[model samples]
Target chain A: MKGISHFLAGVAAATFVPGVVESAAQGSYLIVLGGFFGLLPDTLDFKFARYFEHHINIDPDPANLDPQIIANAVAVEIDRAAETQRAVRVQLHNIPLGPNRWRQYRIRFDAERNEVVITIGPIVNAALAPLDESGQRVARAKTKAKIDYTYDGEMTADIWNGPSFAFVPKAHGVEVQFLPWHRAWSHSFTLAALLGLITGVLFGSLQAGLVAFLGMSAHVVEDQLGYLGSNLFWPITKGRSAGARLLHSGDAIPNFLAVWTALALILFNLDRFSAPVQNRDPLLTPWVYLGTTLIMPALILIGVYAWERRKDHVRREVAQQADIVAELKETEV
Target chain B: MLSVIPSIYLAAPDETSAFIVLPGQKWLLERRGYEAAILTGIGSLCGVIVLVLLSPFLTEVARTLRIILSPHFGWILATVTLFMLMSEWPKGGDRGPTNWARFRAAWSQLAAGLLTFFLSGLLGLILMYRSFAPVPVAFVNLLPAFIGLFAIPMVLTNLIMGTRVPLQHVGGSIDVSPALLLRGTFAGSLGGLFAAFFPVVTGGIGSFLAGHATAQRDERTFIISQGTSKLVYYAGGLLLFFLPGLQLARGGLASMVSTIYTPGTPQLYYTAVAALAVSGAVSFLLLIPYARFSVRFLARLDYRTVNLGTLIVIVALLLLTTGLSGLLIAIPATAIGLIPSFYGTRRMNCLGVLLLPITLNMAGVGPDIARLLGLA
Candidate 1:
């Protein structure tokens, strides 16, 4: 089940990586595609969780979804040796995304099995979806009867693991990690490496590795691009996310590239061509692409430099105050 | 010269002696009252325009001519311009070229332009008011200020003219000199040439003052060293009294408010302004040829005494124009005309502190008088 879940996760990651890159190169129209495609797997993870909760006998209230609480409860229940009449539901209850940190999990808590399996979607995707049975298919009066409904039993479904879970912060809402895990691929790297091996059996190692790497990296980058940040130090700390509110919806690199493509289209139409065409994409003007791409980084760097200077000044003043307090204490002694 | 014109015309003008006679005779004196009025009105209108425009131009021409013809002329021009610029608000200093020499040289050009327009405006008003038949008694009452304005521009232009380098090299060998300087022993004297009626353009006021000075003593001397007598000084200072007319024309709300009370309505105010501007321009045109001719004429004669006699004769002629002419009309007209000039003078100076007090007083105290009289 773990291997199958991990493979499904790899496949999902594979779909997103190329989509984001292609969209970025296509200019603004595809930027919308990139944003939607980037959040798809994350949203699916929560949907599976909701499905699990409904199938399980556990009357898990959808409103009670603090990761820490779940972690503590699972720790206590797992450690106990009683005939725990535990009912487990792994769910992703759909809830409206508000102005706060959010997480959607494909969570499974088992008492008899003594196992807790949980996977989280990107923080940006934790939002409510309508609870409807129309989405799930059921066969009636068939030769092979299928147990389609499990509304009063413990959930036994294997959750699909995607590359997005690679950077899901360790239990969420803890600041032990220095930088966002989203910046670097976590579980995505291993998944891509394994997928590359499988692809090498079918295709060639180089092509498979390139395709898998590209797919896995795109998923990681897209999740990181969102404001919630990603867990880049995944297996080690699982408590990493990075990014500020500014430019939160996408990675700076892709956003910069998308803007460059749009600008190139505009400049190309005007016929004031300065750079040689890379490909015969008549829409592609090289100067605008090169200029905007180069200029934006410099501008962002300058802004960062100024912010750091001001921050350093504030730190110095704070240190001075601390020194004064220390001296006062010394005198008191 | 009187006999050179047909004697029969002067003898035949017996019918309209009352209307035709003007105070100073230049040509025909006898004419109908209506003809006199139309001519005087047109002439006054023309005079005003010329005074406003040409005055500044003439001052520039003088500075340019000096720059071209003389050594250290720039310093002299600067000194004169600054002195004229600073003269209005006299700070306590020994009054002489030596004491104020440095300052005089500093801002001379700007001062010259300001003072020239100022002096010409005064003269235009005096000339306008005097042109009226049976000059008004109220103007006569304000004679000192009127004559002072009319007189100041003349004195300064002549002083400027008299001091010009009348001799300049033309084509390397020959000196082209002013004609007035060559005419006779008395014709080229700087003092006398400056005093001439035709030569000095700022009404004959300065000549009149200089003459007054000379009359008190045997010979003319430096104004600072010998000192203009108290009477002459007061007469010159009385020029300030004309500020009311100019103030009403331009200064504060009173000027705008006075539009209602001004005799002929707003049209008349415009007409008066237009006339002064026209006259200034015309005067400017007439003076250029005259200045050129005089420079060449003066170049021919010996420097000792030729120009002085001619200038003396000219000053004598101007005296006849102002003295016999009704000061009753000319004086007040000039005084009223000069108020705007004080504003001009104030703005031209580096420090305009003197105008500040005067402006406050005029804005403040002038209204109080109007209120006391219920004129407000």
Candidate 2:
């Protein structure tokens, strides 16, 4: 679900508060609070948690290892992969602080042997000079550093424990991982419950706290619908559970339906609360309400779903044809 | 009101250019040098003249429309707007770079147009319609809405996506042939005239129609014509507000002005026209330096930081003006806004937000729909 869908779901929940409670002091505000709470789960993961998580760093001693050698070795491997028609790529970054010291030099290798280099300042440390036996400094020169390339075909390269590299296959390519804390405690159901409890205690209203819990839980559950599942139970669940792969975050129809449904419900609630006079002679009869609010939106959603499935079927057919053609070409080669 | 000024940056590419002037058009403009600029200027002047000439007739038509449509027209229009949005929904998935993909991409523009229209209406009704709420908040929430939907998203995408648009140098003496200038001006002005006359028709649509009508083969000519069309849509639209006979309120700025003061005199109309002319000239002069400065600034600064700052500013402004409710509205608006870019559809679908509601009102179904939903 998109961000707005989550927020709307929260708003829709608030609209469902009993009419009597809504008339009570700060009732409307509390209901609105539910909507805000609905956004809390994703908000925690995207706005706060993502930043706290760190990427794994692969730092090599600049004094002994020239980054150029690594760059060349990676380039060689990329070329080899390309020659064999295997997809691979490499990304290089070099940031210089001074003549001899560099802020950072990072290289990223992808499944397809494509190389992308980002450089800040200069590549080599010009200030570093080797001393001769007579205490005279030798001139700065370019030197190649040797890197071991021999490894099993497996993508994972855990050469050392301190700077372990894990290559995980992704939709686009293999993601070279340096850090492990993704979809952890922050995306946990336990945390959401705790937060809800804390909020309830502070606000002196169990209902308010429940709204908070519902909001957070809604987000966690929605995320579980995607391929990347959340750590539902946090400490008890050590790893993310495999998700029910029905849709992606980017899928348009599901997101649209969620938002539309939420909006429709919210509007219905708003009409009920705001127009007491109209309620006596309501413009929308029960039948009309059933047709417009529920039936129409549902029909549109169903239509979109069917259309998408047909499109997907067509896409799969094309992909299979392309695969067959590629196999034939490889055999010819 | 102050926040409206920043909206120009958002409006420039989307509302002003209307996505008619493609990359190819831009490249042609750059390649053509001074000729393109001169032609653009002439074309804009022509557009202004056409708009000025057409104001009285269009205003009368608009007045008649309001009277005839009155009460139920808003609903009917709103419904039509929604249908337009639905019709434009992108159908195909990621099919690589096939012709079908391109066709889907082109058709998806309607989706954006619909979404934007819908969002604007939703926000307006919630914030401005006093009849529906116990405590009606009369504050104009459009600025914040636009900020969240268009401005913030644009800046954030630039930052997070790390996609840098290379800015080409636009400098040198301009030299346009008189024939080219005349042709471009006529075509552009005609487009502007049509846009001014029609409700819900933007400059982009007008220019696009004109481009086809005139069979404009040259990209440079198309770019120059679009430039003129934008000026007419904005400046000429403002000028129309002051026309004594017309009393027209065409664009946002003009609509705002009309709320404060009614136009009834030729003297005031002339004054407004003069102001527009002076402002237009000053803006033209400022544009070159601003463009150059922006290019350098973008190149030197980290786009991520720039975008982050922009996002913070928008949030602060939203909080200051519309407060919590406005922020809440922004959350949904942003998500809807992202749909176009995310799905690789046209951003125009977002316009359906306003169009759907407004059209529904005109059709007399809006109130019933509202009643059914308990919002009436």
Candidate 3:
């Protein structure tokens, strides 16, 4: 679900096709296309799409640094979207305190309470190291409609940039979509196929086209396994489909599994299929290698992750019942 | 050793020798300098064990991979080049007069990076063909250029900014876990071996790839992995020098060593591995005092004065080593190296000096390109 996982998955997908590995051994760059296309969807969304989005900007003022005002502004948008039925898109920008310094803050929409919680966090340097000069405080504002913002923790506006949210009116209430510009038309199967066709024609090789198509689709499929699926169908269906929720996108174990599994597959393919039988001697032997590198490690890590997630779920349930909105605590060195 | 994290930043070539220490050095020195020294000492002992154990297996894999990937070096190099160049984004220009102005300002960082790469590449090409440096000193010809590109700019920056070195605290213990260590070693080795084996792929690139493969978000993991990566990349690259079948030169030291000696034997290779393990432990032992000494000594000195003295020594050495001609090369290289800091671009682009020329040669078009530019 991480960018690297998607990219590596694409490269691994290319190795599956016959002749691709051998061609790589023969000095062909067709394999690079796999990684390029694999990372393309996310690249499109983050690098280009996010910049072009039309959103109501909530540019915080470092001079005043008011949390109550910011909280009410967010509540008004969620309420307006619920009552008006027109999706309201908002972008919260970080407040710059000085050169390479920012006034950090947090904004979380509590669904159960129908309130937007705002917390003024510490002023942090470029490295997200709090300057120790500023103190933190909290504020809250009520909304008329049910707050449908979904996230496990508060969105911290620090260092690089801030987060965005789209309050779209659903049957239940206004659903808050984080980074509304992401995973839309860019993650489409339709676009992948079209691009594959064009690439094939341009390269005069069907294999290149297939690799391109498979690489991008691999990303879409991987995302489907996470909490938030991409807009796979894209033009055919306007919104993302519900994901399997097998894992969180930011979870470390699943990401490591994906990366290591891809590496194993690549090494195996490189040794097994890259050359003739007489010359080739495989380093990554069949089942034995897979059992050791892929199977055993993956089994142990996944079991641990499952255990941890269950514990986290129980803690979350307790926290939710208490009606306490949790904020990400800063660590002191 | 080359790396982006766990110390060893680009444009600050000083990190290469102490890449493992540099990344965490600031924090460690500021808080618990003594603990870092002790742990790294033990880490060296562990490194020796890891290297000795991995030697036999790594040698065989290296031999085979070389045979398979030798011809494909061009594309592999190109892939790394493309990935690095494309991955960079706008660091500034969030506010400007017009849309186009902001767009251009944002793109300036990328442009600066590209300009640095191409310019360094041009410098590499010029140095490769021209006899600016005397033939007697030709073996160490690029020394001045390297110092200019990687080392001098950092010193200059420190001198210009009137930087200060703060007093360090020496703590007794460091808090860490076995799992963290294992993860760091695993990730570091993967990256180091990848860089060590690849013809032109630097350790920085290898570590970058490995970092992505591991998906490590934790700061401690980053520090530990890069520490391991330096050991593997530097030692592994050198190990290739004595490999029975695959005696290829890489990195500055190995390439220089290759000029005087040629090694090819299984027994000798094993001996080198043993020596590496032993020397690694010894060096780590020496590191504690040296690191402690630096903290103590630097605290009393002015950063500007130190940087100024280093600049003088570097220039004097360059002049003495290759005469005035090396200075000729260093001038342009230093100017080119300064681009990254001034324009807020990537220092890794400075690697283009070696990467471009080498990639072009492997692709069999270096001559053609040089001819076009009248350098051939």
Candidate 4:
């Protein structure tokens, strides 16, 4: 779920309780505070924890100067290192064009072919373009380069267990390193409880603390609905809990429904609190509210889900036809 | 005319409209422009009709509620407005750019959010302090805020961050199918009616709900619906103020009108409706030429230069309308406004500044907190 969806879920949970709305009218805006706390877990992970994680470096063999040659040699080295339970590294140099202009490249490891491929991307200019011989623009010109290398190492089985890589430019060369594990202690339930407790203590209210706890818990649970589950037990459990793969964070319909429902409920709660004393009649009757807040959203969700599924089906059919055509062409060749 | 200018600017910028129109609808606009336009026209016409029909009942409800809720009305309005602002906050995505670049972007966003927050707080304090006679018009401050927060940023971003505009086919006539036109109109009018009748509800929200509820299968229908919804939300909302037995002001434009000219007659209501129709038609005709000119102009010009010029114009306007004090308030408001984009959260959260303070006041704790902060 996106941040808005999670925030709204926490808000919806708080607003579901009529007491919270009533209390809001009486000078306690704990529900709003709860909504803020709901956004805290993700905020902490992305803004703070991400920076602290160490990058794993993979340095390529110094003998292989060309990226293509280095990629091939590194692939073989990785396989051997994985089998020996040792780390392998790679080093790629930035392709310099001028005083400050250069071409940066990225490396991708192809697991199926047991190979590595290098592709040069966009040009970066530190300053103004130097005129070419034709007196035309030179800085914006495209660079086209692609290289592939195969590996025939004995340790193909354990390559999957090895760390992922990100290429960063250093003075000597580009360093490829694995990014550290995310959604660990930062996403744990234990941390949420501790944070809530501390917050409550600071505010001098147990209820406030409990609201924080609930908000954080709601966020964790919502995340669990997606593919990237959080480390629920935290220190007690070292790994993430594999989530129910019903949807992804980027699924538009689910995200929309979550935000829409939350907002509607919040509005209903606000209307309840702000209504005049003499007119006790609710603006929306129970049935209407249910229809708008629950049933209607549910129906829309289903419609979107079905539409996406149909689109996926059509796309897959077309892709399969293309694959078949390509295979036939290969056979003919 | 007052609402039209800002509304057009807000709507004209593709960025905000991108949020309103679904992805599929944009594709439809590019491919089947005629169908899209027809659907939009039908939807808008239906929305206007619905607003006209519902004005009497909605006005009565609004009037009754206004009398009953008058004491805490300001607080409620302030709270909701804050929330609305927060919802508009932009988010920084995990992808694209290096850490340093991302950090700079985040810092700028934070600065903008903080500026908006403090400025809004200052405005609240001023309202609390004394009502200025010959008060600045409602949009005097709001227009600059919109331009600074929404317009300038969009223009700057498109200039700095965007790629060259690709050549696209633009000429087309309305040739929508009857079924699509009806469905689009019905859905749009329904949403527009909800916005027209409801408090704190805008056309954007209404159209969003309608789009989802109808599960519009095509981009053409969705685009049409959004078009109708916006018309109803803006023009229809204003028309409510002219209603005979229920001459109640609903939006900023209506409130300003009420401040200047009293509305009480059925004749005035009919006249206003006629005027709305005439202005809307004229605006629609003008939109085509203006949009075409803007596209051509923007494609050739350097975005950075345009952005710089826009920034200067906005600042000048802000100073002229609100003076030094308004500029001071705007500084903080701008910072707060920038937060949503930096944090990768919905800008709507900025609304918290108003919602939190005003809601607290309504609940009777606001004054105490203000005193604690020494604002009181």
Candidate 5:
């Protein structure tokens, strides 16, 4: 199934790349159309998923990991007060700061038992560590937070409403945007892959995994090409920018014309070699059309061949297993 | 339209299709205005090839000029290809190279290869004059080129076998015959040329008629019951023909005149329309009763547009060819000529599949290599 996806992708690339190149002077819109076509299936599925969660409310929480909070706590640094003033143990407040208007908070809770010890580490100090220790630092921080806030409202609020936005588990601080800082990182890839894997497991096949991964990845990639940026390297960088500029909005016309040209070439010259426009006659764009037409058919054939081979291999294995079982039965007799 | 000559009579098929389906017709015709775009693309591709090959002899900027003018080039290729196809009569046993060898051998003692070339050129001229002038010339120009490229190997292979016999099955045993070999060779060469040029012309017109009949039949089935008056059938046929012809001829006499190659008056469109009107009225009169019988006879058959179109086209072509043979005999032709001509035309129709792709590609001609060949 994974092989199938790779094969389809190859076919698409083969057919579409030549088609785009043939119409290259026309512009990027044609390529964009190809990209959109690639992502069409997943986009439809994403809508379905959205409807299921928001409308039907069947399993609204996408994480589907830990449903109940396990622990909640607040720290204290107060002396006893009398009368009108209660004991001032701790204060909790959200401090607003960044471009996302993200607010940070710090609070301490009094412990009833010394058995449950408290530990606090430096926030920015993890950046100074060796690469191996970096994971440990983040893990340690998250684990502590999980233990402290799991049982309470603040933890639920943060879980449901943080900068992190994903249908499945994603690293903290990742956000969804039309333009992401990087590509395929942050929230998109992880959630898509995880969901797909889960779906495949439940379905007893890998098709779901392929679909999930392709759809999610395409979505992220599409956004990454936008004017604003995406958080492509979520775990690595706590930064986001508006423009990483892989594509822009001005390339619509040329793309359309190019596609039309490609379709024409495909229909007309199913077999004959097209004139190589770039190499010889610039006016005669045979090679481009030829390449475009051949790519899909060739890739499809390759995919079919590989699939047949796999099927044969499976058949052989089954036959061999049957033969071994027969021998064992004969020996037993 | 040919009926005005009175001597130019057409044979009616035993049964006409109430419906039709043409190969590739649905894809081409139903594509909105974009059908032209697709046609242009195919045309450009073919045209561009010729342009590039001939660019060296033209201007330095010929290469650049070719791309911009590719559509026109495509049209030229399509048109020339069509002409090449129609010039030959396909023989059942002869394939091109193999047949050419026998032709050469039959005249070998006279002048050897010189006679063969001379005869070929003469045949080319005859074909040119009969079909209109320029078309045959273009066919001849392509003749030497095609022979050099493809026929030489085939001829050599045929010669080594001692007898230029083709594969034939007889009495449960495989055998070859000289006559069969010649027939195959002739058919192959001519068929290839025809297929390369006018796919639609050979079968398309017939197919279109059949298809129109089928569409009408389907529409009729919805509108009335089989128990209805027989006149309904004729009416349906008339309606079908008139609408399509009118739609096709809306540009009028200008369109009809354009097909003449040598331009005359602008009234040719009116002539065609008028001719069509007369034909429709006559066909309607003849077909009314038959249409009623067809419903009962064809009750068991499913008459979709495609099925009707196919049946109609085959029947129409068969009748047309037969009628042509009949007309050829009126003056001085022998029985041998009539029978052979009928068979040849029927066999030649096998080449009809090649036309539409070639022709549509040539429409709206922007740039084409056929122009250099003087075929465009």
Candidate 6:
């Protein structure tokens, strides 16, 4: 789930807390606490934790431009994780070639061949549009350990500081993880409750504490629907628990559904509790309005998304195929 | 009283919004501008239809929302401002001579983005506390500043880089499926409605929230959704102001119109709906030819010249409306606007101008800040 989804989920959750919405309608800022906490988990990871994580940095030299070196470097990390029964986090630095120019590369784990596949791709401009078709080659290095990675998509080290990964030693093999720093201690129910307790103590309002707990809990639960589940109990849980695997974290339909459903819930609560009964016509029956507006649309969109996803070869390589900078500029938010 | 065109115009790529521009620019470059623009227009039509169909029910929703959100607007605005600032990660800066260099380089871009936002926000604060544009032209006072912040930098960049608009293909038909359009419509409407309903939330932010929540990745779906969201936000926001008993004034159109007239009738509300549908059709009808004309024009002229002409026209207009004082405001704004491009930051940070000052005001600290800055 994205930031806005969690934010809205927190807001919707706040609406359900007794007296929150009524006070909100009457000029109280207590409910805003829900959104702040709801988004707090991700905010912590991306803003603070991302920097603090001790990563084995792999910065490729533009002058050298060798794929084999990169492949072997990654293979060593995987082997180390498995042999030592420890987790290893690796950060791949992109090769820069002057102003708005970069030598791009792709790294994908091959579970079938038991190799790390590395492809040094074309020299791309600011938009990740290839400057020329030249300067491209592929290299594969055999890994000592059989990798057990769930992610099928290739992590392209083009722009955006590339993607980060962690290799965890599992009983079966070395498990590969994308964005290893994310969804760790921050996205935890334990942390949520602790923060909630702090808020309650500070504000001396049980309502405030509940809003924080539930708002953060909503983010964790929503994330469970995605490919990667959050560490619900934080330090109590050794590693990230596997998700329900229902949808990709970046999938459009589920994100939309989450936002829409949350919104409908918010609206229903607002209309029901905020408006005076004497001045208002009866708000639509909750089930009827929700069924017509939210549930029906959710079903249709889900069906469409699922059907389209049948050809899901990593979103059919849309991001890779399209110009990266072009896409980023258009969707600046 | 129930005009939708104001919202529609407001929705156009401008200070607060204009999510359609970059996608539209890409399509125009690909020669599919015709189809893309047409599809977006259609997407907006769907948005209008949704707005009109839901007009009756929305009346109650609007009234209830105003009551619920009136008190909490301050922190809500503050949260959005905070999110907008915090989310942007370093685009690049992995390289430099040393660790400190690398750290500085990366943080530099981040700092530039933050600085851009804060600087623009300072400008916003100045404008809010003191006015140089005069009272009669108050409605258009922000126009010059907007043109400076958003428009001038791009024109200058194009001129400096010698960037050209690629020759476009005037394709006859758009490659769109009913399913895709429906998805776009659904996502876009969600965004537009969010923007229209929420105070201080613009169509761009709405589209962004909707896009993120919906995870629209496909190029076409993203474009169509943005188009729809913009229309729904602008027009839908205006429509709310005319909702008879509800009459919750929102958006620029509603704000401006409220000064002169007040609307309180079902007939007026319904008339606005009818007008929306009709005008939306007319806008779409013109989009096809307009896109085609643009393709032809770009094919002939040097894009540099086009940008040059644009700068001249913009500066001329600024001078005419705001006198020399507007140009003074523009100079600093243009400089602040360019920070994102030079520092490898998100241009969206430029929105800090409006978001920062407004958030301060809503939070009841605007006057204090103004006094602290000696603007008061």
Q: Which candidate is the best by lDDT?
A: 6
Docking class of 4: incorrect
How big is the positional error of residue B337 in model 1, measured in Å on the Cα after superposition? 93
Candidate 2 vs candidate 3: the lDDT winner is 3
Candidate 2 lDDT, tens digit per residue, B1-376?
1111122222222211212324232332233223334445545655655555555455454554343222222322332232233223222221224435434543454445555566656654553342321234433545555566666666655565653333344566555555455445555665665465446656655564344223233444555566666677777667767767777677778778888889888788777766766665666665555544554554576645656787898889877767776687777778767765554444545555445555555444667766665666
Tens digit of lDDT per residue, candidate 5, span A1-333?
011121123223323333333432222222222223233333332212212221101111222211221112221111111121332222121211221121222122212221112221121111111112121111111122111111111111110111111111123311112111112233345555665587558756454345445544544444444343335444454433343332221222112222223334423331122234334333334666456545554455446444534544323222322222221111110
Residue B143 lDDT (model 6)? 71
Best model number under TM-score = 3
Query: What order do candidates take by lDDT, descending?
Result: 6, 3, 4, 2, 1, 5
* Model 5 CAPRI quality: incorrect
lDDT of every predicted structure (CA atoms): 0.29, 0.49, 0.71, 0.51, 0.26, 0.73
TM-score of each: 0.20, 0.43, 0.88, 0.60, 0.20, 0.86
TM-score of 3: 0.88
Interface RMSD of each: 47.4, 20.8, 7.0, 13.6, 32.3, 5.9
**Candidate 4 per-residue lDDT over residues B73-167, each given as its tens digit:** 44334433433333332223122245455445544544565555555555454444332312655445344444444444445544544422333
Q: Which one wins on DockQ?
A: 6
Interface RMSD of structure candidate 4 (Å): 13.6
List residue ranges in candidate 2 displaced over 4 A. Answer: A1-333, B1-45, B49-137, B173-222, B293-298
Kindly indicate the candidate among 1 and 2 with the higher DockQ: 2
Superposed by TM-score, candidate 3 places the C-alpha of residue A169 at a distance from the truth, in angstroms, of 1.8
Superposed Cα deviation of residue B282, candidate 3 (Å): 3.3
TM-score of 4: 0.60
- List where candidate 3 sits over 4 angstroms from the true fold: A277-333, B1-46, B92-105, B129-131, B214-216, B258-266
Give the DockQ (C-alpha) for candidate 4: 0.05
Distance from true location, Cα of A90 in model 3, Å: 1.2
